[model samples]
Target: MCRIAGIFDPVAENLQQRIEGMRDAMHRGGPDSAGVFVHPQLPLALGHRRLSLIDLSEAGHQPMIDAELTIIFNGEIYNYLELRSTLKHYGHEFRTESDTEVILKAYRQWGVDAFEYFNGMFALALWDERNQQLILARDHAGIKPLYYSTDGKRLYFASEIRAFAHAGKVFEENSKWRSAFLTFGHLPEPITTLKDVVPLQKGTALIIDLPSLHIKEHRFFEWTFNGKLKQEDEAIALMRETLEQAVERHLVSDAPIGLFLSGGIDSSLLTLIASHTRKDNLHTLSIVFTEEAFSEEKYQKLIIEKTGAKHQSFLVTKAIFNQQLDDAMQAMDQPTLDGINTYFISMYAKAYGLKAVLSGLGADELFGGYPSFQQQKKMKLVEKMPESLLRGLQRMPDHRLRKLSYVGLQNSAAEYLSYRGIFTPVSVAALLETTEKEVEDDLQELSAYYPVQGLKNGNRISWLETNFYMQNQLLKDSDFMSMWHGLEIRVPFLDKEVMLMAAAMDPAIKFKKVPPKYPLVKAFENELPEAIWKRKKQGFTFPFEGWLKENEYIRPSNNAEQKLYQQFQQKKLSWGRYWCALLMNRFTPLP
Candidate 1:
């Protein structure tokens, strides 16, 4: 819940100024305190902006160091208490009860292997004075973000891309990333919208040697779904245990916390657990839509009654939606189709005096809670068709079924590109001033980078959804939206231990025959009211269709609107498409 930045140069004249600029840009992330540590030779400088969630004392101040190492860390180590006990065996004296100190001590005792002992979200930079090497690592699931850029002579890193822009690097927009953005709704991970900057991939670590300037990246963790256990009951029980522990650990915060109760199974379960831990009634917040079809107020009301938690709800209207759309887009460090809801929710939480809120973000990805998972199973029949026939099918007219069929013929990565994509290759090309062939070529190039081999069939779709769709789209969106209101969001379901346990369960149990997030629904069956469990997963629907039709800001071309309106009238396209078109129109200036 803090911002960290640093610079590493074997030969640099003034490193302090650069570190100061980076820290200044990240002031919004941490306003409680700020500190800088410059090495004796000025070759390395570490900057930190503290949020003071844990110790709330000057003793928790970081660039925290021991005799061997100095560390600039961002994020929470939920298992710091556990690690502190283990480090005591090695006679490491702690000056404060801070996770930052625990991390420095653990790294000193166990080296890079300390990442394995951590059970929380983090991105840390440890300057090993003894080894004369700098080690950078992200949490197992990438719940927090770390971005870095190197010019061979100097390496600069920060919690946000904006911070890096202040380090005297020209802000050149990356066109290829923009192209990917148009297709995927967000720039996929390992690649940012900036050419020179890159995000450290999830479950990976980097070690940089000071003298040689050589950098080594290692994959410290990987999630696997293949498990030998076959019993559904056993899987449910194990998932319940892991998830409860994850939620309990995430609740370790000094500030007043709440849950973003969506009335969905994931959030419902979180609210229940948080309520159990609180002596007083738990505070639960939810968004209510004016449009009944998109409202979950009834379900949320049911959960509040069942749990006996204090509840607050906000009514979102078209006016609020229109006003916030522009600010939401500008707040994005990377482009994403989601986050509008997250932004509004976080804003509400902040206004209500809540500093932190637990979210149920990763439950969908970890427990097979997307339609794409079940759809991929049905799509498996396409592999049996001849390559020639599949190629011929792509030549068919522009129809929804044909579009879906073409996606089925593609590889897992390409299929994923099509599934979540708003504007298809044909559509984007036709709409843009550029040629369709160019867009297709660009998509192919980007698709090549997708980790297709690691993902196979439904599992492939699941991984792509988790690592790419959820990471780049949902998680990125949530981070900016929540942070914009200065509210820290903790996703308990995304905890490494919980995710690993879920990943190890059989896919059949993870995605039951009933529907998406079936396992989660089944695990908390008794705790949740029957009405809440039986409700269809609406998937965070905003009243986009109603909003678009009401807002005058969105004025589509007569021809386009007529066709789009006709489709809407016939229910050919879900309300989502009209909403996308409306968003594009709202952003587009009149000729």
Candidate 2:
């Protein structure tokens, strides 16, 4: 994994300086090496910061060029060896042992369709000097980020939005997203905090014609949960086999690799699998707490014992949290409250002398491993209730009930927000000083990532969890926070094959009411500790409820929002609500 940036300004006089500025802004993502490629004639420049994960030699350095095709890429292609073998059958020659080279050859062989064959996370920009067009593509799951902005003539793109901001002050605040941010606690896909800066959607590519500066989008993949594997046994087998394969593939790193062992169902299973599969001793890092209620040390210990893992656990006291908090938050490429836990753990990983680490991020989204999945049945019942009754439900004092005001069921995203939303539209408008209609309109744009059909129960909730919550908050947080320490965080659960296999599993087996992640637990029951699966499901989270209270930076800036903080401390409100307010107060009023 690395950082990439470029400017496609046909009229720019100082392309090198602009590209280098963006590259320097993202230097933390790739501290080992850096490279720049500027067209001799045209005023276009491509910049890269290399982390040196797969191929350690200078040959793997990016802004790679081969036969008029120039490329700058971030994220690893885990299956590059297999794809390279196949490409060689098509009579392609390789000069280096690098996935970036494989990508250049694959594009020549299959064009845009080549994306289908890649099984890893990536966000890349390819300049085909022959065709005089620039192509941009992200991975199938959007695990990697690619942000771009246009001023009607120039196109600027990067792996992080901050790269654009520092490139001679190219940043302009997009105040329109404040409504969405207040409602969702995060910006939805294709919307960034900067004006005209948007993320390139995953499973899609944009081809920019160098001459006309025209851009066209091509979607190569779209996620859907059709549940074609109806038989429980078949679904179980596929989940087991695919997960094992994903764990194996994610271990393909030239540098010292490890995993973030949360001691949750997903991470425990991955540790067990990797311990047995990896040639070297499995390394793991975990965050412990002095607060017993918040720490997962007990569960993490269970996994380490079972796997015989080389474990490193750090205790995150409020003192340490406060001391490290500034640098961690500064590492945020975009402002969001979700990544603080990740920020600390990634710092831990870097100090452990590891370059890449595995995470179990997508398992909950894929296998119905969240409370929202179990709550879907009640939501379905509510969706069938009278529209008048549903409208009245909004007046109730309960937070989730108040969100029901948006439940038309015509939009899955709208309905999902009713369960998972941070603030009700009315509440958001009052908080952000904007109209409710404006908030709703901004939220409506999320339909691009919505489920294709009217899904029921677990399937509906999973789609929303994956596309909305996972993509926007969890995955985005993982990208910037982990990369802050120059550590590449790879999620095996979000692997292309693993996602497809999990999406096709029978929901009845996958989303068993008795236990969350039933399929995942059952598939490897023999391999996992009984204590790990039988334990009540607790998410891997920092002690924010307790720690936020200890934080001086978390205080209310004004009395207008003081009641919210009081409610939070009194345990009448969720820490998320209070934390969202803190984040909003700190990051908003953007310039």
Candidate 3:
């Protein structure tokens, strides 16, 4: 809901100025208000840009401080009223009816374990003045971002990486992460595109002692799918109840709330539940296409009628795509293969005067709605092939066989990544100056040290989809792109409670073969019409490939990149490969 930045150091003369510079870089994300905090005796400083979502009064102002602790926070804490009541029981008095004050008090009451009680999206930095330590924590799902860098003297952290970059912090593109970007279309969690800068992982926290600079990392929560199996009807009941609760919690805001209706099952279900929960008329937004094949106005209309929601649809023409491309590019905080759709949607929401919106981003990952779910069976078969044969098949001319070779050679995480990635190691190397062996070695090291380690079959695939794809691409894209318009995008499906419920369900129930999101659809069958559930899944994309044929900026100075573009135009390249090449060429500066 806001942008937060800070400097933690033993000695920095102009700490306030540097912190202000970081906050100012992301001024668009929180144009409503700004504040900075610094003490004369302390070298630390914290800066905040407020969007004013929960409490409109200045009482909600951040870098909120007491005698012992000071806090800078971003995103919503939906259950703040409840937490506030609990803290009152503990004899903590609050001056403001704002979540910011609740967090400060909660930290006082529960210490580091306070994170376990928060039931919403957030990335926060707390300076425990008494302990002389700084605590940084991300929400359970990483719906918000927190990036940090340390020079062994000072620690710089912010809501966006560009903040640090703009505040005179130099960020050299790390070669390893650059190569990983070519393969995955995103840098994985804790790995920023820049050297020495790290994104705090979801469900994780870091404590830094101010004087010693000693750091300790803790995993407060980890998503796992291991709850008791239930009868189909019972499971459906649980899913329905959990989803409705999540939607209600996500609706907590002082600002006007809107829903991004993609005309898909996830959005439709949310519309149904939210309409039932909110007393006022719900505003719904959708993107329509002039291209009939790509449009879904009919389904969107169905949801509107069913929910009695006021609907606003935007028609995207080739002209609009051309017009918005530059603005979207400038809005981008990090180079991504996705988020162009989110950028345009956010602009539409902003135009309608909406400050906050709900998206159905994590439903696909949580409920097995992607083609990757179905491909797991084939992967298991490929996994049976001997390593000797896989190595030999790696030399095969047929690309399909070569991809199968990857499945045979690597673990489930690496194999799933190879299946969903932008490029194979060999293909990525051909595009970059790095060799194929170097790319393979980096991938091997990553797989060996994988954080979501030791999960198998469907569970393994789910972890990768949620942790890597959703964390890196979907949620990260949502943050920068929507915040570009000074908008807050909330995901009910990624809510801590909702994620735990979905993760705990038996994988077999979540991944039935007939319709995608089988359990979720059944849970709300009365709420969502069958037509929405039965429709073929289409990706939320602009006419990017069509636009690529005409885009002048897509042309690259690098010969390898140009060749990849040529292959894409000739229809000889994979979609992921073509997009990676286009993005690299568009973003990489010519010397």
Candidate 4:
């Protein structure tokens, strides 16, 4: 829960100005304190902004060093104490009780292998002074962020992209990235909106040798769903045990902690476990929507009664929504269509005097909890058709039946892309001032790089939904939104141990035809209320349609929305068009 930045140059004389500027940009992330470590002989500097979570003492101050290594780290190492004990037995000495020191010492003993031994979310950079090498690494699932750029002579790294702006690196507004943004409502990872910078892929590490200026990226871990347990009962028991341990580990903070209870099964389970583990009465925060279709207050009330935890709820009115929307949009150092909910909720937790909040973000991806996962059987029927026939089907008129036929004809990635896309390729091309060929080219490029495997027609949809949709979009939104408020959001479901176990379970067991996330619901059947178990999954959704329709300040004037609304009023276009227009306007920057 901190911000880290650094500069490495072969020719530059000093890095003091660059380090200070980067630290200043990340002040919001860590308002407690700041530190900088500059290599005495080399033109290298590492900077840190402290959030003061675990150790409140100045001893925890970082750019932490052990004999020959210096480190600038962001994120919690939950297993630090255990790792510390292990290292101490090997004759490693520690000057501070901070996890930062633990990381330094562990690396001293284990080298890059230290990453595998770690069991927490992190994005860290360590400089081995003796070796004259810098090691940069991110956690397996990417709970934290790390961005970097290199010009063959100099390398720069930061926790946030805005830090680069302060480092005097001008970001060119990449129209190619903008094109992808217009289609997907997000600029997918490995590629940021900026042309010069790239996010280090999750589960990967980079080692830069200072003398040679050679950089090598290595994969440390990958999520796999192949390791199934022998027995169903054993799987359930193991899941419960692993989750409780993760909850306990994540609770290791000096500040007050709370749970972001959505009243959904995932959040409810977290609340239940945390209430037992935490000595203090657990504080639960929830958001209720003003829109009837979107509100989940009734469900929240049920959980509050069942758990009897001290509960606080906010009713998000149109006025509050409008204000937050504008603030959130402007908060976008990178554009995102999601995370407005996360931003406001984190803001609420901060106002309530909580520094860390637990969320159940990765459960849907880990377990089979999306509608697309259940639609696997339907997709298999389409895979049986010949390629030529399917190509012919896609050119049919844009009617409801024709749309379904077109969907049936698409390849695995294309079908999954359609599911996650805010606008169809046809619609995006028509709306954009650019040529259709360009948009199609971008889509094809994205499709080729889309990171899902096991592309059999049926379960391949599930694979794509988890890897591409959840990884690139949902998780990215959660990280930025929560960090924006200086609040540390720990997702218990994303704990490595929990994820490995969940991945091992068969899809049939996870998502039965009767109810989605069936195994999870069954495991907690007695613990949860009947209403909660029976209720349909109401995802975290904003009332974008209603908001656009009623907004008076920013009325549509001969624009896409206005034209679409006119068609709706004239009984030509349906409500779906209005929804599409609103999404298009939100994602596409106005002239």
Give the TM-score of each candidate.
0.90, 0.96, 0.95, 0.91
In model 1, the runs with Cα more than 4 Å from the true position are 9-14, 279-281, 381-412, 431-438, 446-449, 454-457, 548-591
Q: Where in model 3 is the C-alpha error above 4 Å?
A: 388-402, 588-591
The CA-based lDDT of model 1 is what? 0.76
Question: Alpha-carbon error at 508 in model 1, in Å?
Answer: 3.0
> Which pairs of residues clash in candidate 3, taking residues 3 or more apart in a chain or in different chains?
none
- For candidate 2, write residues 176-212 as lDDT tens digits: 6666666788887767888888899899999998867
Candidate 1 local Cα displacement, residue 176, angstroms: 0.3
lDDT by residue (tens digit), candidate 1, 8-55 = 776565678888888878776787889899998647888998777788
Cα RMSD to the true fold for all candidates = 3.7, 1.9, 2.1, 3.2
Ranking by lDDT: 2, 3, 1, 4
What is the C-alpha lDDT profile of model 4 across 253-330, one tens digit per residue? Answer: 888888998878889888878877663678999888767788888888887777788889877777788777766765
Candidate 3's residue-wise lDDT over 26-145, tens digit each?
Answer: 998998899998866767788999998888898888878888888989989998999999999989998888898999998898888999899988999998988888999998888899
Question: Which is better, 2 or 3, measured by lDDT?
Answer: 2
Specify the highest-lDDT model's number.
2
lDDT over C-alpha atoms for residue 348 of model 4: 92
